[model samples]
Target: MPFTGQLEDGRPFIATLALQAHGTGVVGDGKQLKFWIDPWLSTEPLKYKFPSLFCLEQDKRCNVADRIPDCNGSHAVCWNWKHYPATEMEIEELIQCHRLLSNVSLSKQVDRWVWRQEDGDGYSVKDARNWIKGEVLSVNNSVYQWCKWIPNKCNIFMWRASLNRIPTKDALLHRNIYVENGLCGLCGEVEESVDHLFSGCRFASGMWDAIASWCNIPRFYVFSLSDVLLVLNDLPYTAKKKDIMYGIIIIACWRIWKARNDKIFNGSVSSVTLLVADVKSLAFLWFKCRHKEGCIDWRNWCNFVLPVM
Candidate 1:
């Protein structure tokens, strides 16, 4: 019924009759005698909506913009559109689509992922596509696409370091020597647990002494890295500074590992001076490589690192 019709006219039905009939509209304004008939478009439920394809998308259908010219100004684009019904989630998807079309594009730093339990693999695909196209969050992975905005109460560098179930290198070291002996290597007065090896050992004490001035850390010993960070988190320093300190702790632990290996395998001895020198040099390199672009620079840590803690 629509073909050879008055298609170009925005009101397609009116033009169709004109084209199919006598090449003139039913109601002629110029002629004194004329006839008019209200077209029977109401026979279908879709009459009100499909004035054009663009209008269909505007009404929350899935048509794209490029197809507007293809429809050729047709009114049947809605095609039996009886106010299509959608589930709540479908409604949400429509809202998201509308946002993507109507607003100015978003910034890259902002991203979001839907935390819906019902979402399947399709959710991840959609999440990635939306993110690559513009600013959107990937909540599927539970990672912060925008971590820089969050206010950190403490430097979580230690926390960020993944904890594994592997046996401690120190325990492995001692176990290689004595399978059941829990004797200490420092004062020989306590068991060689993590606390005893790193904190109470004569060798470990010597290592701490060298970095004590540069680290300005307190003279207390904790059993684990978690304990160290737990105490450090409460320091009255800025979050940025705390992150730097956390970096220092990680580097120090790494050096401690090296020193332990040196003592155990190479039969080489370590000194506090040597360890301190290693910590400062490595800390400087770390800050230069990681934070060179920031307003805070390496020299600022001098007083803080040099403090006798």
Candidate 2:
């Protein structure tokens, strides 16, 4: 039986452990498995993979056992698709799923969960721990590449901005929040989206140009926030230089966001000159405080020579 809160104060931990264990677990039989919720074939749950079909399902809690209908003479298993497709896309998806599952043959064996992480296909605490550790490292490497060097606040801002999670006008609108207008505050011609607010706006484009010139880097295109976050990776620079560039990029994003908020809340305006100056100042302060390898003066920072020395 599942542990209740009254019975187990540590139920949450057990739940988390089940989630972690489920990542490496695969289905051996169709019985005792919810058709929609179980991760039988793919890493994603079936409900997520086939949302339209799942929505049309009469029994949302129906298991795989209920879907497999017995054949007349042959001992073959067949799927009973009880739900109808609502759209052409859903129809195509259903056909695809049907083709994929057509080859899966069921046996009289009992339902069992097998761990894919272990060599013997058995669950082990060590294997689960290693799998969870690897998952954490993979997520951290992709999302927090520059978090260790930059300030937490700045890193978080950049992270959210890059993922387009900030409550921008467009984002709010998408979430069913009504706004008077969606035009960018800096450049009123374009929509105030994450890409436009940071990279596509004329004002933002000018700021990028100024930053590039100040950093002594050649002209480069920044079509989106992803370009800014991943610019250092594509550049042919030393690791130290790349680290400094990463911090500067984060500072620029944070300052741009601040300028946007100021315009929205305080009716203040930001110029390219002011934005570049702030980036330079903030980058210098952050690098000086957080980094201690080399001494960086104001002049070197302004001229973008701090990377060399």
Which candidate number would show the highest lDDT if scored against the true structure? Answer: 2
TM-scores of the candidates are 0.39, 0.53
lDDT, residue 58, candidate 1: 23
Full-model lDDT, candidate 2: 0.68
Candidate 2 minimal-lDDT segment of 10 residues: 2-11
Error of 2 at 196 (Å): 1.1
RMSD of each: 28.9, 13.5
Each model's C-alpha lDDT?
A: 0.41, 0.68
> Highest TM-score among the candidates is held by which one?
2
Error of 1 at 119 (Å): 46
Model 2 ranges off by over 4 Å? 1-144, 307-309
